[model samples]
Target: MIFTGKGFRFGDNVDTDQILPSQYLVLPSIKEMSKHAMEPLLKDFSDKFKSGDILVADHNFGCGSSREQAPAVLKELGVQVIIAKDFARIFFRNCINIGILLIELKEADDFQDGDVISIDTVKSIIINKNKTYTFTPLSNFLKNIISKGGLVNYFSAKK
Candidate 1:
């Protein structure tokens, strides 16, 4: 699978609350929840995103809470992928469970916000301008789940 988009940047240790504050958690639907995504960290964040945009972040992205709503809100906001130096484990799993793609790259700092980039998950490459970076490819199992649009859809297709 490959994804291409302009980047949206964030720093290290961005937690669930920064992604979506608890105040908005009680809101109904992913659409309502998404309105507040990154509200605290980047006011009017929802207004800045376009469909198919990419999120780039430093290490420990998604550092607090095991809230599934975090990734869910991002997905609802049309963030196609997140490339971070590293991820908080539970958040990583939650992202996969909900069909949002996350990639780890120790050299994540190489790219800046709004850079047009393309990711070739099959080749494990990230292309930005004339530069290229590599990342560990997702396993076939994980790829299958993402392709089917998350675990629920993956299982539903099987049945």
Candidate 2:
């Protein structure tokens, strides 16, 4: 997948709770869930975000809680790519497990808020303005798993 969208920039240690505040859990659907997405960091973020926008952040992104709902909310808000300097292990896996593309880059901090970015998910390359950076691509096998909608689907298809 090639990501084409505006960028939303943030600093380090963005935890799952901030992504989907606990207060919003009562909502049943991602559509409703998105209304409260990013409530802690950016006021009016939900209404301001455009579909297909990319989220760029510094290290330890999604550092707290093993909440699958975090990714679900971001996906619901139409976040196409999440580029970070580092990701919490569970959150990184959760993104792939749920089909939200997550990537790690050394210079993730360089991206500014509202900068447009184009990501080549397969190549793991990101282009921000005139600069281009390459990230380690997910292995083909892992890509296949994500493409098929996670490990369960990968295994089920073998049955």
Candidate 3:
């Protein structure tokens, strides 16, 4: 799949709480919880984000709690992809489980906030302005999972 979006930039060590605070976890739905996403860092992040927007961050993008709600909230807010220097392992898994694309690139720092970026998962390329960066392509199995909308739907379709 391919995704194109405006980049929303952030710095290092953005933890789970910053993505979706613990207080909002008690909310009934992800839609409600998303309104509070990135509240600590960017007060109006959720309100301003649009579908297909990309999140670009420095290393350890999801470093704190292993709460799956963090990525869930972003997905609910229509964030299609995230590009980071690196990701906390559990958070990385959580994002994949929920079908939110995450890509790691040492060159992530090159992207600026609001820069329009195009990601071709099929080609494992990230294109911005006059530049292009490549990432390791996803395995067919993983690609299938995401295409089916995460593991649950993947397995459900198998039945």
Per-model TM-score, in order, reads: 0.94, 0.92, 0.94
User: How far off is model 1, as Cα RMSD?
Assistant: 1.3
Better of 1 and 2 by TM-score: 1
Which lDDT tens digits does candidate 1 get at residues 39-154?
98988999999989899999899989988989988988888799999999999988988988889999888889999989998888999988989889778898889888899999
lDDT of 2: 0.87
Cα lDDT tens digits, model 3, 39-155, are: 999999998899999999999999999899999989989987999999998898888789988899999879999999999887899999879999986678877898898989999
What's the distance in Å from true for residue 104, model 2?
Answer: 0.3
lDDT of each: 0.90, 0.87, 0.91
TM-score of 1: 0.94
Backbone clash pairs in model 3 (N, Cα, C under 3 Å; residues 3+ apart or in different chains), count: 0
Candidate 3 lDDT at 47 equals: 84
Task: Order the candidates by TM-score, highest first.
Answer: 3, 1, 2
lDDT of 1 at 157: 95
Runs in model 2 deviating more than 4 A are none
Error of 1 at 140 (Å): 3.0
Clashing pairs in 1: none
